[model samples]
Target: MKQIVVIGGGPAGVEAAVAAAKGHSQVTLISEGPIGGRTGWDSLLPSKVWLHAAELAGVAEHTAEGVAIGAVHVTPTEVLNRIKQVAQRWSEREAQRLQAAGVKVVHGVAAFHSPHELIVRNDDSQQTLTADAVIIATGSVPRFPPTMKPDGQRIIAPRFASHLNTLPPDMIVIGGGPTGSEFASLFSRLGVKVTWIVGAPGVLPMFDPAAGAALAAAMTAHGATIHQVDVERAERTEGGVVVTTADGATHTAAMAFLAIGRVPDLSRLNLAAAGLEVGANGQLAVDNYGRTVAGHIFVVGDAAGGPMLANRALAQAWIAGRTAAELSAPGYCPHTVVSAVYTVPEIAQVGIVSGGEGELQRVRASYTASLKAYLSDETEGWVELIYDAVNRQIRGGIAVGTHAADMLAPVALAIQTGATIADLAAVFAAYPTLSEVVFAAARAVK
Candidate 1:
């Protein structure tokens, strides 16, 4: 049997280790943190809990007719504790799953001694391990721009959210991506003054500009101040924090949340020893199979460096793990992945490949067209489907509003299956639902 060593204990690493073991390989997973590591503990799962809280708060804050719902109060300590408990339970379960998979787990710091060799060190002992294949899923850390660094007090990162025993009266959120936009939407809806600064003209640059624009407008309506400019520097004051923009303007808030994006944490890995050099891309580049230039080695997840998305990491882990154990891997198509941003009115999209050489039609429909939108009182959103003129197929789609992700589910599957417009138009939702808005867009294609 092959000996496979996977580094890091995040979702990606654990999945890879289990996958390799299932393929009849002897798998060893080396991690320096608790089960689930950064993803389950501090980053992905924890942030979602906070966002879910924000979602609930948004609903309660809306006063209903003939209702006596009192003012909703959020205690920071309770929220912090709740998030920890949820994350801990999930992490512990993952630990049990890893053990059941029969993959040896090592809690230690790992550094590459050679392409096929690793040196792992714990506080009390150091050991060396040899493997036929090495998968590096060593997650990522928030990347701080030259002049903007979190001080753990007035200025903070999402990872420091556990320390949030008190929500600021006002906060500035930097970075226009999913992390920044979500928090901006969350805090503002929760009645905290929010100043969100985006380097681009709008949020969620990866999605359609219209979706970002709609989200930004909603945030503004929820009492957030949006600054569509780059931030030059941020510093703490006697009472608050001040952020200077690239345009020389200044904005102040009681606290600053730096969602400035993340980069792989490979500083301690000593990649040079393994003959891996992180070049102009600022990361060790890998192929679609998750294999590095050094064929026997692979890097997946945030460490592989593209978008820090869990779906992408999971896919890469499956492919790399199976391949490492000499088993066939179902090839991954980067384009087939769908992404969703969990703001109040969410955004979801899939960028399908354009059918060979023909016009692309963007069929649009408003939430007003859906009976469910009226039922949910969310008749303000929209869905757009991309129709390939040549193939007469529903190639891709985007949604913005309540249950946007749910509405886009069929579209995403359609894109993957290369479903024609007629195929999608005939797809039934069975009821008056948000997905009908997406179907309405497809049926509108003429």
Candidate 2:
């Protein structure tokens, strides 16, 4: 049987190890931190827990007349504890699953001594492992600027922000991507003053400009001050932190959350020994099959470095693990990756693809058109569908408002299956539902 070694116990490494074990390979997973990486612990899971809390807070603000809903206060320590408990449970569950799948899980720091050999060191112990194949899924870390460092107190990154025991009186969020936007929204919901300094003119640069504009407007209405400027430097202050922007303006807040970006964590792994050099941006270059320059080695997850999405990591891991184990891998395809921003009245998009001019068509349906949204007093968002004008086939769709993420799945499936606007419109959507917006969008397509 082939022997496979997978590094990093995050989403990618765990999936790869499990998939390889199912094949004709003896799999061992090496992880320095707890398994499940950032997705299960520091980043995705924790953020969602906070987002859900924010959502619940938003719901409580709209108490019905004469309804005696007791005071709901934001408890930062309790939330942090809940985040830790959930992440621990997930990590433990993943470990159990890996063991059941016949994959050996090792807790240690790993570095390559040769192409096929790895030296793993844990406190007070060490081991040498050799394998016919290796998979690197070391994941990524928040990129801290040289001029400004996170003190883990006033100045912090996403992971640190999640673990904050006390809510700040006021906070400045740098970087207007998903992480920054989510933090801004969360703080706003917690009744904390938020100043969002977005690098881009609008937030969520990856999505349609309209979606960003809508979200920005909503955040502003909900009490967030936004600056379309990039943070250049930061300095420790007597009270908190002072941040300077590229536009030569200085902002001060009780705390600063740096959602700037992330870099692949390969500092421990001396890649030169494995004949791998990270790209200029500190990302590992890998093919669709996740193979690096050294054919015997593969890369996935944040180590492969595109969007830093957990689903992408899981998908790539399946391909890399099976191929490394000499099992047939299903051909990888560039599919529509659906993404969402879990703010109140969430924003979600599915299967977006670029097309030639005049060939691409867009149609929109407003939330106000849905009776359910009107009844629920959530009539402030819209759904948009993008389709090929010539072929009339749906390419992608975006939904914003209550249940936006939940409403996006069917559209994503339709896009994947090459369903047309007419096909979407033909679906039997119940009256007054949020999903009716999708059917409305499809029917509006001309």
Best by TM-score: 1
Span of ten consecutive residues with least summed lDDT in model 1: 349-358
Instruction: Please provide, for model 2 over 279-315, each residue's C-alpha lDDT reduced to its tens digit, 9 standing for 90 to 100.
Output: 8878777788999889999988888886877777888
Note each model's CA RMSD in angstroms: 2.0, 2.0
| Predicted structure 2: lDDT | 0.85
Q: Tens digit of lDDT per residue, candidate 1, span 1-446?
A: 88899999999998898888888789999989898889888877877887878777766766455666877876778888998898889888888878999999998999989878899999989999999999999999888987899999999988887667888889999989998988888788777899999885568887778888888888888788888898999999999899999899999989999998888878899899888999776689788889989899999988988788888899899899988988899776665666788997798787653344458877889999878777667888898888777887777788888878778778777777888888887876757877777777778877
In TM-score terms, candidate 2 sits at 0.94
**Model 2, which residues run further than 4 Å from truth?**
64-67, 353-355, 429-432
- Runs in model 1 deviating more than 4 A are 63-68, 352-358
Give model 2's clash tally: 0
Q: Each candidate's TM vs. the true structure? A: 0.95, 0.94
